[model samples]
Target: MTDTALDMSVETGAASYGAASVKDYVALLKPRVMSLVVFSGLAGLIVAPGHLHPVLAAVAILCIAIGAGAAGAINMWYDRDIDAIMARTQKRPLPQGRMDPDEALAFGVFLSVASVVLMGLAVNWVAAALLGLANAFYVFVYTMWLKRRTPQNIVIGGAAGAFPPMIGWAAVTGDVSLASIILFALIFFWTPPHFWALAIFRKVDYSAAGVPMLPVVAGEAETKRQMLWYTLALFPIGVAPYFVGVGGPVYLAGSIILGGLFVLSAIRVLRSEDHKPAKQMFTYSILYLFLMFALLIGERLAA
Candidate 1:
């Protein structure tokens, strides 16, 4: 081929590849995480002791999911640098040059604004305000500031994730309550141990990225100990729903069994030489939370 023709072909290939890459950027919003946020938020809405129109409830859940996705997008945009260095995150959209960082930023901002506005107009201002705060806290406080700064980042930043259930409750009640706060507390306390287990296996990624995860900063032994401690603390809070009168015997029974299993897993992690316990604890944690909320909903529905 002539030199001019070869150059033109190369340029065309580059343009096509660039277009294809943009799709990957959108994937970095962590749709799975958004799904969990939506599900848990819906559970809260369903269990809350109030009557909301079906349409309004659906709108509230939609806003919560979109706000969470926006926060995830912003997190990806800001953490692109660190994400590039981590093995687990190196293939994310911005780091892989699938999408422009500015494009992601603008998309996140647009979603954040649109979600909040829709939520406020359709539901109560209280829910919409909480949604806005959660997004800002995740993007600016957790992703931009804390992720690289301290081992306690997950401990504090977890509040962002904990807000969804409370927002869901508030959307129906039009205010916050002790019951909503308890739901928030459940997720808040659960987050550190859940995340620390992953860090135990992924310590090298955090070390390479200069992120001070619990395992990277506190060492495996200390992280395991903390996980055990948190799991034990979680037991009481997990059962609090029963005393609060929101949960029935079914929920109480399930909470006790699940909480015992969680504590046992944490103890095994502390005792085991291999990382198998941590891995098991991490996987089971997802199941534990899902079942706990599911039982709560079942009780409410049966009542």
Candidate 2:
């Protein structure tokens, strides 16, 4: 699991790869995470004041999804060494010796450029720029610079994930606005507690990979405390649109309920040492973001 061991295995993996399939390439994209990004981006597009043609709207979402996938592929390529050491990631194509890292990197770069260029041609340049920035930030800033260097990596690196909704908003409006920025803030503040909850239970995985996640670098107690703090901050950001007259009573009420449950889960994580609470917190956090975004989109449709 050490760096030297990882290097040795990676060299072996590079020499002998199997006949990898299309599915393995898709797996490199981190499709589940990209789904969330697409959904949130769509929600932003739906809530924005202007309208986009149905075809263009679909294209916008497609570009966003592809950009996210490109970033994820690059991340996987860069992290393959440590990924082989982690239990959850050991089965990944690169780590499993089923795909070459160079191939993954090339695919990632190809998709990254194509997505941005297509977005610019079919949609607006603003959206394309945001997508490019998000890809760059995730690949260069978060993956290469922060992941191995700092415990607060997710805090700052989270800005990369936060760009999707803004990109969606910009696609329709051709400009960013307070509403879209609020959407961005909501996700930015939500990232820390969400990832930290996983880190709490996956401390051993991070330690083995030598990644400096909060729990691995800061200890469980500090990480738990920070989770509570970030969750508290996230609740207000989640509900901010309601106060700003962007979201309605339904969105307001739903966010309140969801945020309350999120905080309660965070409290459980804070108060308990059992892995059960952290696992529960991680599950609820995903539901929390999904439901909150759903409420906003539903409110927009109802209006």
Specify the highest-lDDT model's number: 2
Per-residue lDDT tens digits of candidate 1, residues 100-196?
Answer: 6778888888998999999999999999999999999998889988988999999999999999989999999999888888988999999999999
| Tens digit per residue, CA lDDT, model 2, 1-303 | 798986886677643565578999999999999999999999888988888999999999999999999999999999999999999999999988788778999999999999999999999999999999999999999999999999989999999999988999999999999989999999999999999999999999999999999998879999999999999998889889998777899998898889999888888888997889999999888988899888988889888
Query: Which lDDT values do the candidates have, in the order given?
Result: 0.89, 0.92
TM-scores for every predicted model:
0.94, 0.94
Ten contiguous residues minimizing lDDT sum, candidate 2: 10-19
TM-score of 1: 0.94
Q: Give the TM-score of candidate 2.
A: 0.94
The local distance difference test score of model 2 is 0.92
lDDT of 2 at 48: 86
Identify the leading candidate in terms of TM-score. 2
